[model samples]
Target: MIGQDDSRLHTAVLVGPEGERRRARKARRQAAAKVETDARRHRKVQARAKWEAEQAERRNTSYLPPAGEAGPAALRTPGRFRLPKHQDTSATLAGQYPFLAEAGLGNQGVFVGQDLYSGGSFVYDPWVLYQRGLITAPNVVLAGIVGSGKSSLAKSLYTRSLPFGRRVYVPGDPKGEHTAVAEAVGGRAIILGHGLRNRLNPLDEGHRPSAVSDAEWAMQVASRRRDLIGALAETVLDRPLSPLEHTAIDLALRDAVRSAEVPILPMVVDRILSPNTADDEDGRLAEDGRLVGHALRRLVAGDLQGLFDGPSTVRFDPSLPMVSLDLSRVAENSTLISVLMTCSSAWMESALSDPAGGQRWVIYDEAWRLMQYPALLRRMDAQWRLARHFGIANMLIFHKLSDLDNVGDAGTAMRALASSLLANAETRIVYRQEPDQLGSTALALGLTGTEQKLLPGLGTGQGLWRIKDRSFVVQHQLHPAELAAFDTTGRMTSDSHEFRNLDVRSGIPNDRRDS
Candidate 1:
């Protein structure tokens, strides 16, 4: 009975409230086991996701070729890299190596200066480029505002070329900027203006080519003289000569040549005013030439007296390193300037026609002033077209490209010729320009957007050079001596003896100074 009671107590302790607690504990243990199993499954799922992420990262990574391995399959080939490396240009390589690139005009020309973009030494020689088939036309067009160092660049190009056996001929230096340069380079500058003893006889036989026959020479002389007289008359008259006026000029030129060994403008004027009895059948020859005669008389005895009234006191020798006609004195008078330039143009033909004349540089400074006259513009156009045949390079320098529109009314022959001058030149150098001129300049040069944007921000001595199909932004460097000799702003900068030597009040240069 005591054992049974103990058993019941044990049972009660185990199965009653105790037994209930024990069963609850058993259920809690079962539930705890199930929670542990669920936690393990969750950990396995997290591990699987981490493993999948690692595999995906490995698959997305770029796979470069293994060391010393060479095969198409070794690399993750991009669509752009399919072409052979040797078949592509660096311009294409920029897409690959965008940080490092260099495109330069080759290494066989003069050391011009520095290439502002590539940080390389810039070199250029037009004759060399032409021989290499890099450019078809050797002429150049340099445009810049005043005081942009365009003057110095012009001087340096030709002066540096002197050692290379090239000569420079500046047909007209309106500011007389080239006077000092010519003297420094061992060249001659003919000074012609009022009160100067120097005289230019345009009728004199110019430099004769070695290949011309007597007949050809005679024909050239007569044609040149007749054309010169007609040009002078037209320029003074401010209109083209009529057919009757042309006939009168031809008769007068012939008679003058027949009478005087060295004909003068006075002779032509007098003959035009009073023709010989034989040529004036109905006395209409004198009437036809009367207006033209008085017009040309200005050069002999009127406002343009003291120059071209007599024989040429100075001769033009083509062998000099440089030759320039200083026209600073007459720049104030448009008519006088045009007349002088017309005479100089006739003079240039003499030297330019010589076959024996070596390669030369013909520079037209202040071209805006020269292009205003139709006669001068025509002569310039002819010379520009014949640049290649004459073995010469013509450089036209003007202040602004808008000067072209100012050359003549739109669609006129002057406008066309002026526009053609720009077209013929394959080498175009643009210095800093005014904001107003940027559009026309960009259009005229076919500059890219970046290039067009580079104009206004350009610093001094920097210029954009477009040579044929290539382009370069170069910083022109000059020696101290060159800066001094090529200086055109002396009057505005520092007043020196050289500046004082010029007509100070009138702003004329020292054209006659032996400096």
Candidate 2:
């Protein structure tokens, strides 16, 4: 009876409100577990069904054989197709790949000729190139062997530029080649030599630009005269002037300026040799300028006397389309040629300084000869460096690139200057080069092996133009009239072709026979 009472108490506690809530929660958990189990079973069955469908579809599909189709439908060889691996530089690959030629400089410049690789028209203008940011420097270095059509190319370049409002100035023409072209284009060529009547007063005030003030013009004239006299003295001395010599020149130049309206070379020579009594206090000034005076006297009273001694007979007209100083008559005397070129270059500089003078082509023909003189080389270097500022393009024409190597000793200042001329000139036009010059030319121009090799095979009128980093092989085209005007081999070809007297003012050949 006691055990039955204890069991009834336990059952009563279990059947209380808390026990009832626990039973309800247990029932909900059982329902959720059954729902989750049904969902998992459903997912498994769906996966199985999808797998069976894929297996059936895969069995029905057909694929290509490992060896490809057979008979006439066969597209593969009997053996495995394979290609040998190849590798090279992009430069070489560019040439090997078809349809990879350069698009070339656009057609806004002067029409030069066709690009060999691109088979398209190749036009070039340094100013145009500079304007378009194709080149930084407006100077150009052109080298070629004789009969390679470099002269013709140069003539064509400048003459073609004339129609575009650019002027041509050949500071010195050693062979008188440009005389005809100058006159043909309505320009003047100042013919100066031992027997010629043309006189250039280095001290005379040169062409003054319209923009410069009178005070600035006077200062420029003074500075140019002083420098011109010093350069001439150095050319005659074949060395640079010392401080004492410069002082002597300056004092004597001042004295000459006060005494004369337009001082000629002789007047300056007189003042330099015999300085004023008041100026030479210690009597040492005479000795100081003795060597310089005697050196400059060469231009006034010595063998170089007749050319620069007197006042101006023919003036430098910068307004003309072109102006060339013909030095062919004095070609045999290299020293005289250098001296005359110095004066002519000075005259041209005054015109170049004029911002209103427009664009001009300053051709340094027979550059090898000009490079021999340090004074001239320095002047040329200055002009080249200032080309962009002066709104001009300077073209240096030479026989070979190695000619610059012969300028001075290894690592000398003159050599550096000569090399700088090449460095500054972003445009390099190389015509047919002799095989012996390949190594040095390639080294100087930074040409690739292929470009270097191409040098030897270039034909006449065919040049390898390296404008900045880009390259093009151009075949220069010329008109029939240009061919006749630019021909330099006439003397060798025709026995009757003689240099008749040229009109003093016009530089055109006349019937006046050579006296």
Candidate 3:
């Protein structure tokens, strides 16, 4: 009986041990499965986060803000990281804020120091502090590459300034883009050419004679004496004209123009080209004089009547905001056209210098061509000097940095002369360019890191804009119809019923004959 009971206990102990081992194995398997499941969940979360980050980058790179949408301050990041307001006033004081934004004024108006933007976007709102007021400074230099939309930007600004009752004059460069703006804004476009009749009856007979007095003629003749001397020095002395030499030449030219009985250009040319003048002058001066003489003679005899007479041909109502000189027809004579435009500017400045009741803006497109001419350079220099007094604001546009260098040493001097204009400009806009040009442009405009980064990505009509205290890149949205209205061919086509119906003639008007 004892032996049987012992056997039963042993059997029970073995069964209990087996059951315990099985239970341990099951728990181990469950633990391993939970670990695997956790691993999978973690990997899925990481992948989702990575996907979100990639999506944000794509959005930032390709997204354009909706028209009229305030520009974004911060780019989106992965997950739920909230960002502060994009514009932080921490650096800017609210009370004496230099920036002023007035959207109701002519589409959109932003005044930064002397820089003005019309039809500009809210993206540019951060740059309002940089514009210069008319009373503060006078010159603006726009440097960009071709097709960068510099001309379009200038035209838009000019049109915007119109409602403010500013007198705007545009030189008739080969690009006649400004003419459409002038016509649209109720201003006249004066086309200067031979046989063109004056639309404005400035003279009693509707014609102004080209003549000067005997004393004036004698003074003009005497003025050629310096040019003759310079020509003699350049030809004989083999020297370049110094600043003093240029000044003397200017005085001489002025005398000749003021004193001449007939057109002074011929006499001026004759004096420079004379053999005696060359003999007494250095070879360089003589060469330069000959070049000048040839250039002047061609200008005078050529179809340059339009530039000198165009302003008088059209009566400018002070109430009108814009005036464009259309010179597309004279493309063959671009240099001559530049000369004419310079002369017209001088005439306008003289007329507006004395208490012109309001402010004015004068824009020069393809300004590089004008830089090639000494007379135009001098005129621009004068504009810089007297901009404040005349309340005249000037915007000079160029396509390349090298273009400025093409105008000789005078170009260098002109660049220096333009420095004040650049410094005083309240706003500076730099469009996309080659990599090399990008650095130089950024340095010139004093852009920050954020602003600099925006340059490479900017599209057409987009650029880095610098105001006084802050800067950013913005895509400018312009009125497409207004932009399309100006033809690139420089011809005001009759396709537009309004432009066709106008009784304006092509070229500066001559004295009217009884018609």
- Highest TM-score against the true fold, candidate: 2
lDDT of 2 by residue, 373-457 (tens): 9989999999999999999999999899999878999999999999999999999999999999999998999998989999889
lDDT of each: 0.87, 0.91, 0.55
- For candidate 1, what is the lDDT? 0.87
Pick by lDDT: 1 or 2, better one: 2
Judge candidate 2 against the unseen true structure and give its global Cα lDDT, from 0 to 1. 0.91
The local lDDT score (0 to 100) that residue 201 gets in candidate 3 is: 16
lDDT of 1 at 396: 95
The CA lDDT at 396 in model 2 is: 95
* Candidate 3 residue runs with Cα over 4 Å from true position: 1-138, 193-295, 302-319, 400-402, 405-415, 418-421, 486-515
Tens digits of per-residue lDDT, candidate 1, 1-515, equal 99899998887766667777789999999999999999999999999999999999999998755573476755655565555547575458767877673477678766778887677888777888888888888899998887687888888888988998999998888889899889988999998788889999878888888889999999999999999888888889989999999999999999999998778889988999999999999989999989999999998889889888888998888999999999988888989888888888898897897878989999999998889999989998999899888989999997888889888899998899999999999999999998888999988778787677778887878999998777789999888887888777777777676576787666667686444
Q: After superposition, how far is residue 111 of candidate 3 from its true place, in Å?
A: 9.4
Candidate topping lDDT: 2
- The best-first sequence of candidates by lDDT reads 2, 1, 3
Q: What value of lDDT does candidate 3 attain over all alpha carbons?
A: 0.55
Cα miss at 11, model 1 (Å)? 99
Candidate 2's TM-score:
0.80
List the candidate 1 regions with Cα displacement exceeding 4 Å: 1-102, 495-515
Per-model TM values vs. the true structure: 0.78, 0.80, 0.53
